[model samples]
Target: MIRFDTVSESTLMVHLADEIDVSMTPLIARLVGQIQADFPEQLIDLLPSYTSILIHFHPDKITERVLRERVQHCYQQWQNKPCSTQGKLIELPVFYHPDVGPDLTALAASQAMSVDEVIALHSGATYTVCAIGFAPGFAFLASVDEAIATPRHAEPRLRVAAGSVGIANQQTAVYPAQSPGGWQIIGNCPKPLFNPHQEPMTPFQVGDQVRFQPIDRQTFHSLGGEIWPHWK
Candidate 1:
């Protein structure tokens, strides 16, 4: 079931589902596309999260009743259409070593698995880009392998470097910029996930697939990846 509420005079919140699943991402994306196509002049911006979409509209251009009706029509259209399996598969190069992954040793020990086993489980799974939040270009990828799923730190780091990959429960994500975070640090991805100057500021979008490719410290340095000195 879907629900709608007015977050503000210009913002409307559309709840498509109660849970966060990869299957639901495409539906949300399609709805966003429909809204953009149908009401180009009225839509100021649309923000899609794990289970809901927040739409910012020009109130002067669209009435509340019209907005609700249009959204409902789009939702119905999304439901009647077949799901599209096609999505971009992005491979991220990650360097997993004790020097960068502070929680690696402890997480492995807790799971009764070797560091290599942990890395294999994490890198092996193809995660879905469920939502982008917490920071700009911070793609929240879902369903990390159960065997390696770990909880976040009781105490978050004062500063987690950009491109640091971390796991908290069933989700995994990379820090787009230096910020305080609590997710268990597992590895570091050398590729910049976000750059304001770049054409596609974030490499990921809703419903995209992500795979982590492991590399060594030497390769990481060659790729211009640097570990924050504060971590050392």
Candidate 2:
């Protein structure tokens, strides 16, 4: 069931589901696309998250009631439309060594597993892009294997390096830029996930698929990946 609520005079939040998962993302994406296509003149922008789509509209262009009607119409149309499960599968190269991932050793110790076993579990599953938030290109990938599932750090680091991969509870993600975060650091991706000058800016979008591949230190450097010494 879809519920509509007003966030502000100019914003409407469309609640698509009560929980977050890969299955709900495609519907959210499609509904967003449909709304944008159908109401280009009235829509200011659309912000998508794990379970909801925040629709910002020009109140002067369209009244609140009219906007809701249009959104409801779009939702009805989406129900009859075929949704695509095929999203771009992005394979990211990650170096799980302690030198790059400071918390790798500690995480292994906490799980009662060796470093190699932890890395294998973390890289074994294919994750779906549930949302893109927390920062630019910072994708929330989900359903980390239970064997390696861990909690966030009690105290977040002041600056998590760009491309750092971390896991918190059932979710995992890469830090696309230097920022404060608490997720347990396990590895770092060599590729830049976000670029302001690029066309898409971020390589990922809602509903994309992601898989992490373990790599060596030499390969990490060869790929132009950098790790801040402060992180070690």
Candidate 3:
């Protein structure tokens, strides 16, 4: 069932599901495309999360009541059409070590596993890009291996470097740019995730598949990765 809630005079949030499930990615992706195709003139923007989409529309172009009706119709048409989850698969090279990822040693200790074990567990699985928010190109990739899953820090760091890969509960993500954050840092990806001047802007999109490939320190530097200053 889909529920529509008023966010503002021009914004309506569409709740597709109550929980965050990876299966919902395809629905959310398709719905975004459908709404854009169906009402491009009236839509200002759309922000998708794990279970909902924040829709911004032009109030002058479409009334709240009518817009809701149109969106619901679009949802109904695409809801059961066998959408594919096989979006683009992007491989990210990560340097999993202590210098860039300050919490690596502590996180390993907490799980009673060696740092290499933690790294392997993290890099072994293919994850889905469920949502993108917090910053441009900051993608929320889902379901870190259960053995290596860890909680966010009780206190967020004042600044987390760009490309820092971290885990909070079942989700893992790379800090697309340097920003204050709290997710447990495990490694750093050398790829520059967001480039405003670039065509796609971000390498990640909702429903895309991501796999972290381990790399050594020298390779990390060669790829243009900066060493995050060690926390005092």
Best by lDDT: 3
Error of 2 at 89 (Å): 1.4
Worst 10 residues of 3 by lDDT: 223-232
- Model 2: per-residue Cα lDDT at residue 88: 90
lDDT values, one for every candidate: 0.88, 0.87, 0.90
Better of 2 and 3 by lDDT: 3
Q: Which residue pairs in candidate 1 collide? A: none
lDDT by residue for model 1 (96-198), tens: 8878888899999999999999999999999988888888899999889889888888888999988899999999999988999999998899888888898
How good is model 3 by TM-score?
Answer: 0.93
- Candidates 1 and 3, the one with greater lDDT: 3
Clash pairs, model 3 backbone: none
Please identify model 3 stretches exceeding 4 Å from their true place: 77-82, 230-232
Q: In candidate 1, which residue ranges exceed 4 Å CA deviation? A: 80-82
Per-model TM values vs. the true structure = 0.94, 0.91, 0.93
Rank the candidate models, highest lDDT first.
3, 1, 2
